[model samples]
Target: MAVVVALGAFLMTLFGGWVAQRVIDRRHLVLGLAGGLMLGVVGLDLLPEALSAAGDDLFGVPEALLLFVGGFLFAHAVERLLAVRRAAHGAADWGAEPGGPAKGKERVPQVGLTAAAAMVGHSLMDGIALGAAFQVGGGMGATVALAVITHDFADGFNTYTITSLYGNDRRKALGMLVADALAPLVGAASTLLFTLPEELLGGYLGFFGGVLLYLAAAEILPEAHHDHPALSTLLCTVAGVGFIWCVVGISGG
Candidate 1:
């Protein structure tokens, strides 16, 4: 049943990537909504659940919060390392000529590959969340599944856009998009093999919440607002959050 539900997410991800390929005009709007949806999930779903499930404190902080910080820093480190590597490689290729047009554009794919890989990892975790939630209760599982399914569209869109934006070939970007789409299915299936402890699940949720929050605030939202900053885009973001709120409400009932 969980796998069946994840199939919906898989389709949504493919649709998102297709939309990204076809629609350039509404990029900001799409990104805005995606960012908003991510924010809503972290705040309204993941964090609360993590807090409730986390069992104890670590160094006077909740274990979930500690994992949250760890996740944030972990993502920050990954980005920084990728940036440094890109800079060094770019400079080497350009021969230290100040502002010389970067010669080895091919190397730029590394950045996108890294980012897309992270998104794929997150999607897998989303599947695990679905399975774990079902183990707890049907209502909880369905709610988590709804959030994961909705957020996955953004995952697919960002996976393609980030890969292409970083100079990867269309084929590579599409490949990653397909992998991201399939990851949840794998994760959901894995749940049948094993279950995580509640405390550990809380920690994982906190960690992933931080990851999604960072991506939404630090990456996606900024990119969305970078060019247009129009009222319509802002409204799209608001509507995205409102949509999630309704989903949460309905699922809770």
Candidate 2:
């Protein structure tokens, strides 16, 4: 049952990805919406949890550092991959060349690999959220499950849109759709692993928070800045954060 719900949640995320693809021409808008949504989630949700999870202990300092660094490193690796792709294409191939698709397929695999790896943490975070949902009693658990499904739809749309735009891979975009569709199932199956010591729960959640934070700051948000008016992006970002805050309050967390 949990697996079914988890799968449904991930599929919703993929559906978001599919929908995101339609607005490919306006990549900036896609990134702006996705980045704003992700950043808002981080501001209203992930950052606070990360701070609280660190607590007032000396040992936890390192864990917090680990969480931040892990996310940062993930971003760095992705950036490096992008850089390498650009270098291989001689700076001209990245949408500037007059070659007109004559030589762009060489790095498609790397593009896909980098994309999958960079976005991979989202899967684990979904699993952790699932693990968290199991706590709200059976009825609340069901509601939580439904909520996961709902948000994942947005998440999928964002990821699909960004990855497809960046990697320029239609197949990979579809693959993202498929993968995210299956992610909730994987998350549901992961409950077996997530059922852990209560003391360790905060650390787990913090890590997930870090992943979300990294996605917002590194992938989606930066893309929002690309080829768009700064003022427009800034306003969208604020609105997103404000909206998320309102929703978070409604969620009572």
Q: State each model's C-alpha RMSD to the native.
A: 4.6, 5.0
Estimated TM-score for each candidate? 0.81, 0.68
For model 2, what is the alpha-carbon lDDT of residue 242?
75
By TM-score, who's the top model here? 1
Off by over 4 Å in 1: 83-107, 165-168
Q: Give per-residue CA lDDT, model 2, range 170-203, as digits (tens).
A: 8766776677667666666777664654324445
Instruction: Please give the CA lDDT of all the candidate structures.
Output: 0.78, 0.57
Could you tell me which 10 consecutive residues in candidate 2 have the lowest summed lDDT?
Answer: 84-93
Model 2 residue 190 distance off true place after TM-score fit, in angstroms: 1.5
Model 1 compared with the native: what TM-score? 0.81
